[model samples]
Target: MKLFVDCKKAGHLCDKGQYEDASFFEKLSVRMHVMMCKQCAKYSERNAKLTKLLKDSKCKQMPEECKKRIREELARELAKKPE
Candidate 1:
């Protein structure tokens, strides 16, 4: 098993881990990278905080009618735009 990872791969793993979609090895690699890289560590920290905030929030979803109206407005705007 490869123990080291580059920043980009580390970042991807961080996001996947945040969503509980990464494998154990991938999460481990990301943890190792975060331990050594300050920027990635900060990024991972912020991502975790954001995830927690989103999970904790009591936000409601828009109604279907509201979503339909927004889509209609977008379609109208796109029709008016030049090709």
Candidate 2:
């Protein structure tokens, strides 16, 4: 029920807000804190940019075959380790 939140809490809320995970009150608290705190404002701006960039980036996932090979290699290496 706390309307006012500290910088740390605001930052956490800001992160959650980016992912659409924060509730209405949480988002409101972050907006309120960011309005008065320049540092948090900048942090929120940069975080937003980062999130946008990542979302816009068409990243491809590694092939499952390649992942399976890597896992097999890791298991083989681990099995060679002395007890």
Top candidate on lDDT is 2
Tens digits of lDDT, candidate 1, 13-83: 99998899999999999999999999999999999999999999999999999999999999999889587
Q: Evaluate residue 3 in candidate 2 and report its C-alpha lDDT on the 0 to 100 scale.
A: 91
Clash pairs detected, candidate 2:
none
> lDDT of each structure?
0.94, 0.95
Where does candidate 1 stray beyond 4 Å?
Answer: 73-83
Residue 77, model 1, lDDT? 95
**Tens-place lDDT digits, model 2, residues 1-83:** 68999999999999999999999999899999999999999999999999999899999999999999999999999899697
Full-model lDDT, candidate 1: 0.94
What does candidate 2 score on TM? 0.84
TM-score for every candidate vs. truth? 0.80, 0.84
In candidate 1, which residue pairs clash?
none
Poorly placed runs, candidate 2 (over 4 Å): 77-83
